[model samples]
Target: MSASDWQKSSYCGEGESCIHIAHAAVDHTVRLTESGDPAGVILSATPHAFAALLDAVKENHA
Candidate 1:
């Protein structure tokens, strides 16, 4: 997906550390810090990889 299409995560809840995500064009998901401009560097990964990352974060937090 285009970087222009990514929206900040709703879970961010007005925080500065939020991340933006988009699935508007490509099958791969893109992520970037909300504090950066839309043109900022983005990390791309498959949905499964992203899910695994989330799971790892949850596990670490728990």
Candidate 2:
């Protein structure tokens, strides 16, 4: 996927440590990457897995 297809998270600050996410329609998977190193490792996960991860993070913080 192209860089333009990736969206920055709303929770991100004006800093290099921002997170970017993208959806791959072909594979129906979610992609995640660190904005500070766009060319670095990109992680792919199923929609369900991604949602679970978000839920876990939210619960942990709460």
Candidate 3:
């Protein structure tokens, strides 16, 4: 995918340690990477897993 396909998180700060997320329509997976290491490694997760992670984060914050 191209860099244009990725979107920076709204919570991102004006620093290198920002989060970027993208969707892969081919395999139906959500991709994530850190702005500081955009060219380094990428992490892929299923939509369900990603949702679960968000839910857990929300629960903890609640």
Candidate 3 runs further than 4 Å off:
36-41
Best by TM-score: 2
Query: What ranges in model 2 sit over 4 Å off?
Result: 36-41
RMSD after CA superposition, every candidate = 3.0, 1.8, 1.9
Instruction: Assess each prediction's global lDDT (C-alpha) against the native.
Output: 0.65, 0.83, 0.82
* lDDT (tens digit, per residue) of candidate 3 on 1-62: 77777888899989757888888789999888887444643788999999998899899999
Better of 1 and 2 by lDDT: 2
Tell me the lDDT of candidate 2.
0.83
lDDT of 2 by residue, 1-62 (tens): 77778888899988857789888899999889887444653788999999999999999999
Candidate 3 global CA lDDT score: 0.82
**lDDT tens digits by residue: candidate 1, 1-62:** 35567677777766556788765344555465455356554666777887898899999999
Q: TM-score for all predictions?
A: 0.61, 0.83, 0.82
